[model samples]
Target: MKRREFIASAAPLGLLFSLGLGDVPFANAQTAGGTPVPGGVLNVAVSPEPTLLTSAFITTMNIGQVSSKILEGLVSYDLNLQPVPALATSWSTAPDGLTVTFRLRQNVKWHDGKQFGAADVQYTLLEVWKKLHPFGRAAFANVTAVDTPDPHTVVIRLSSPAPYLINYINTYGAQILPRHLYEGKDVLTNPVNNAPVGTGPFVFKEWVKGSHVRLARNPDYWQKGQPYLDGVVFRFIPDAAARTVALEAGEIDVALGSSIPLSNLNKFQDKSRYSINLDDGRYLATIFLTQFNVRKPYFADKRVRQAFAHAIDRNALLKVVFLGYGKPATGPVPSSVVNYYAAQTRQYPYDLKKAAALLDEAGLKPGKDGKRLRIALDYDAGGGVTATRPAEFIKQSLARVGIEVELRGGDTASYLRRVFTDQDYDLMISSLHRLPDPTLGVQRLFWTRNIIKGAPWTNGSGYSNPRLDTIMEAAGREADVARRRALITEWQQIVQEDVPVLDLVEQTWVTVSTARFQKTALQGDGLFASYADAWLTPKKA
Candidate 1:
């Protein structure tokens, strides 16, 4: 299997982050030093310090949390998966529907006291479209050009009537940047990644590397009298247990991206210290699995891949690895994304007999010398949520079908380097975050170009299929979403039959917070999309 073929066959379940800079003195939210109504600071514990801080290149949750607060996108997705105004108050499409014009909000002002205009909007798209800088390539992939007609009106010209462009534009990667501050080579070493300036509700305060990042309210923010909290602080805590402990001890006001173990869920729920919200379907979901390198002789045959998939006992896996929170995956696209995902579409039920049968069919028989199919699996153990136990359960399940599973664990930095840059794994097990736009979600993992040999973002499995490639490209350029979804379903069908990737389960995420924080929702996409609309209820202390 070629590198692109591997990506197309792999099922994706992951998220990313970015970082940028700006630094004003850190001021305590406490009403001291003559700052009126010094608001209470909300403390957040993050897992790691982000590598890239720019809106275009953020690849982890740690950097995303900070960037979201400091930056604003042209459009924003609401809880119901609808687009709403952000930097742009309203927009209209040209007669051909390929050109879109957006009118910016008049009162918006950057944190640095600079007035935001169409020039900034035009500059951002132009810089990102050129791909001369890092991370800008992914932000505006379908954009052909951008035009700023006036101070408050911006137009975007598309290569085609791309259906998923709206959804893609509102994501973390497309956050509008300050054109003046980030132009030319200066962006390579821009100070904004460590300290950012934006027109969001919060303004950058300070960042103590390896410790915490601080943000203060933008008094003259575009939205009047918003962001009730005077400031917010994100504290970096790599350990999940430590994050839970801090929340209970009041050391932090909110904890994101970490899970409270299922065994401890009942205990925590009974206590009033915090409220637990679990979308079991969305949070505790499909078991995490690996995409075998079809390029290898042992797994090259379709029968071998199918045999390996059938060998794993998903029923036992849910009980042991997920603690009964999630269920076995029926197909590549989770049931949460579509209601019609049924056994008829794709179901690799656990049948040891069938697995052994397929193994024999593939010409791999148990030899007298006890030689069996032995494959090394790479697993990231850098902490957070998924790495805790699922990987071990996967190893045990694969062991039953004459496959010797060697599970390798490493630090975060080393794990990413090996997976993305080195192409050094026979089997890889990593979690993915699904998006409403299946084309964007699926393409990110399966597109052949994303995994060119030696490229950092290569989808390591090296399983490729041409049919999938045609379907993905067609779906991306489709103008009608209904048609796009149909094409995506077709693409999903191809991925399921290929067996290069064995999707174990769809993981669910639980958010434990105070009930007083009304309108706080962890969207299915796992983003605080409507956070700005959230307001604290005075009904609770």
Candidate 2:
């Protein structure tokens, strides 16, 4: 079956929006109708050099934003958060919904000049995606086989129906890798990861470790006359204040992951010089959470987790830490995911008396020193003040309930190792990007099968509820949209009652860009976009 044939046959699931041209406007680009001038470099500010260049293993958004320019997936989400074609020209699903076929685009070449075909997709799905990807393991759990009948045709046969498979393939799901290069080599230690070869708009050039990573435009890009800029340079700033200073001084053209300090956002309101885009965050669904390690004796009790939840006030965290840039989250899924979000779930109101009562009921009584117990809490310092400030606030709140928290702050790598690998920390304050669907993001938080020992972002909390797991599995296979949503709602209620992970706040990301750049449309997925769609505007004399 062809791409158009599938679209015509399958009824619209309401999740698929209209493919209108430029339906979602770029947050702050000057769209006033001047010709796009090419051949200039676009400078971006990134914090803390990414430990891994491969998106298959990366936990932080910094690495994905940088690597996206070098790697092209089978599909990408547009500004409206709808699935759009990338490497695959079109796709169709079987009548039973257990099979999916993708029609590849011809003449697409990898950076190494080799033809991109079905084999590349097959290898990426079997080796990297199904086995190694954090979200893919659960998303593709029902996949029985991936068949490539021809060079341009790829078919996926599943044991059951997966409605959200297309959504995953659009974002982190289907990043195609060259089978010839990664087939027989150690994928984790492959040299190609440091210097990648992809079919993206930019070609990998050089990396100067902790300083910067550079990329040149791909002249032979599939989208002809694209990647308007000559090159792109990502500068590692680490400090949010320093990133804002660089943007103000015109040292950088754009900030990738909203590294600019929230207090300094008002200073860049000049229309002619800078464009500040505080996006609606529909595509970039992120939920700030306080994760508990149920493996620890102190946190194994549900009462203790509920006590901590009632102690901390999410509204205060929004104002004090985010500067009123986000909303208080209710569950693992953020409000931006409108289809499956259950707003009526259990809410934890801030009450010190209730918190104290619950702690006492859990048998955690204070000693003569007036401290119930001491627990270690860690936060990611790479997120700058946004992360550290919240940790400080949580420490103060937990102390009021007689639970002493030793706050520990570290870089992205250290925090990942402690929580994911070592599993030594008692509590962790971190943010996870909630995808458009619950199956893509929320399932990994509580799924028992996803509790991979060495994995960085998959069920690190070691949380598993048999009832919730069954609901998640049924939701993945349910073809009826309403039935799947009902299943998701049931799972949310269970998670709220269980209190495995406490939802804190949903953040709103702000991206700042210089007026020298044009057509800078920030997609729903986050601040980053295919630089190919962006062009440099000529400066006035």
What's the TM-score of every candidate structure? 0.84, 0.86
| Candidate 1 local distance difference test against the native | 0.61
Give the alpha carbon lDDT tens digit for every residue of 180-248 in model 1.
788774554788767888888888888787788888878888876677677778787765567667776
lDDT by residue for model 2 (329-353), tens: 7887777677788988888899999
What RMSD does each model have against the real structure? Answer: 8.0, 7.6
Weakest lDDT window of 10 consecutive positions for candidate 2: 1-10
Candidate 2 clash pair list: 26-521, 283-524
Candidate 1 wrongly placed segments (more than 4 Å): 1-39, 51-53, 93-97, 129-139, 259-264, 278-287, 339-344, 369-371, 384-388, 413-422, 520-531, 534-541
| lDDT measured at residue 164 in model 1 versus the true structure, 0 to 100 | 56
Runs in model 2 lying further than 4 Å from the true structure: 1-35, 51-60, 280-284, 296-298, 360-374, 380-386, 410-424, 452-454, 526-528
Cα lDDT, all candidates: 0.61, 0.76
